[model samples]
Target: METVVDGTGRAGRSGRRWRITSMQVLCALLVLAILGQDLLREAFDAPVLQTAATVFVAICVQALPFLVLGVLLSGAIAAFVPARALRRVLPRRDSAAVGVAGMSGVVLAGCECASVPVARRLIGQGVAPAAALAFLLAAPAVNPIVLVSTAVAFPGEPAMVAARFAGSLATALIMGWLWLRWGKLEWIAERALRRLPDTEGRDRWRVFAETARADLVDAAGFLVLGALVAAVFGVVIPGDWFSSLGEQIVLGILVMAVLAVVLSLCSEADAFVAASLSALPLLPRLVFLVVGPAIDAKLFALQAGTFGRAFALRFAPVTFVVAIGCGVAAGLLFLGGVR
Candidate 1:
């Protein structure tokens, strides 16, 4: 009886520890801000700090709605759309199926986080791995929400939207074809290839809600981090770097490509973050958009877990190179040789 009571007390303590939620953290931060208001105000009074704060707020405000929308649509796809249905729609020929999969991304609006599981399910449902990969690459980048957000973010640069779409679609198709030609099935993990049963009826809504709630929590944290990084870049980075690199476009492209991988911004929110970096020319920013949804640090981790490290190691680097090449070509063609 004494052992049982002790075990119960320990379980209760563990439960309490697990209950320290994000909301609790946020409330604690809010309380600290209130307590330290005078100190914060004096610190933020610096012109650079003030600018950074403004940029951070602006990015969060502009990107939040789209982020919410992306997650909701993602949940709907996960709940309503069955993997077998997607497999049924693909053409018998692998090449044609890849094209169809790439184009299909326009209708299936979701962030990159949502695409991975769906792609895994498609593969398990007997869809061609190459075609499933094409969808995974394209869904986050070419969807209406992302393009519309890009249009809103850039406002007047219609070509930015066009270039992003063309570049992302091209990257998807190219990667799919490459996989068809050279990828090994054994590279994917046995667990990832296991088929999942589809959700049905009333259970679907439960899934939709849970998936949306979980994705919003995960993506929102990353969105906030991306905004903070953009804010710092805008104010903290030396102005001369942007100025000098603007003249050396190749160096600018390489830098933005690396930033895209490192920042790992959500597709629905990356545009606003990219737009905040007005120091760089349009081409580099376009590369940031194209490469981010294709592969980033978080995405590499996700791929490593889902497809296995061997697959991710080979696929991510190739996708990065292909995305950059497509981004540059599309920018030159659509943006007319970089602004």
Candidate 2:
């Protein structure tokens, strides 16, 4: 059974509380528009609304297909790739293992949220914690949609594409290595891998369907949570915040990294947020992009619940450093000088 929604009314409701609330808020805005007229227009028509819409749509479009892609690949891997085979493929040494693990994301496409369960399932099936950690960080950023969106975000900067991919890969691998050396697997939640009650004896197609359906169901609430966060970030956090940071580029990047961790916006959608930081120069904003997929508040929360605090504490900071370094290099190459 799909955990978020089971192809039923309750499930659908679980998935799209925003569509409903959006209507409610929009209707209220319309009412305010009629009664207060110009006042409502003045408040609602502020640039913030436009900016929010721009960032919101960018994230949703970029993430949804990739999320679907990731979930499907994860499903196929679970249903088809024998656990024994996976165990063989994942390397044993820490750095090499991380490299092998991180590269696995090259084939799977997904957002950070979607990547979590897949990683958990892999671990359950005996894929090393090192490899699983790498996959969790990589699957979101290196996905096609994320890279393509990076290209879009930078307009003519083809290097942005390379930067996003390389940065995401570097962070994931290095972080994986760190975790294997210093982190433990005690962080993953037990309830995360429970089997669905009635799906046995099904065909591969059915298995895939069941997996995808369950993913969509399980992720619906999270999707709503992400959207609401984007919506709120839309209303709060003025653009001047970035502009005001001045020359604290490293500090700024670190701050945004923290924000990325907290917000846990989908990889697809995070680019627009990074772009809107036009005031913050390119490097830090790039760091925002790089750090986001690997560590975000939403992602951290999920990880803590499913992967454990020990894993998170070790994994998050190392991933942050690697990603920031990548962003700095990319900025020097493409952004001229973003110090």
129-243 per-residue lDDT for model 1 (tens digits): 9999999999999999999999999999999999999999999999999999999999898887887665565588898999999889989988999999988988888878787
| lDDT at residue 294 of model 2 (Cα atoms) | 79
Worst lDDT run of 10 residues, candidate 1, spans 8-17
The residue-by-residue lDDT of candidate 2 on 33-76, one tens digit each, is 78998775676677877666666666566556655655676567
* Candidate that scores best on lDDT: 1
Worst ten in a row by lDDT for model 2: 192-201
TM-score, per-candidate, Cα-based: 0.93, 0.70
Candidate 1 ranges with C-alpha deviation above 4 Å = 1-20
Evaluated at residue 4, the lDDT of candidate 1 is 30
lDDT of each: 0.93, 0.68
Pairing residues by index, what is the TM-score of model 2?
Answer: 0.70
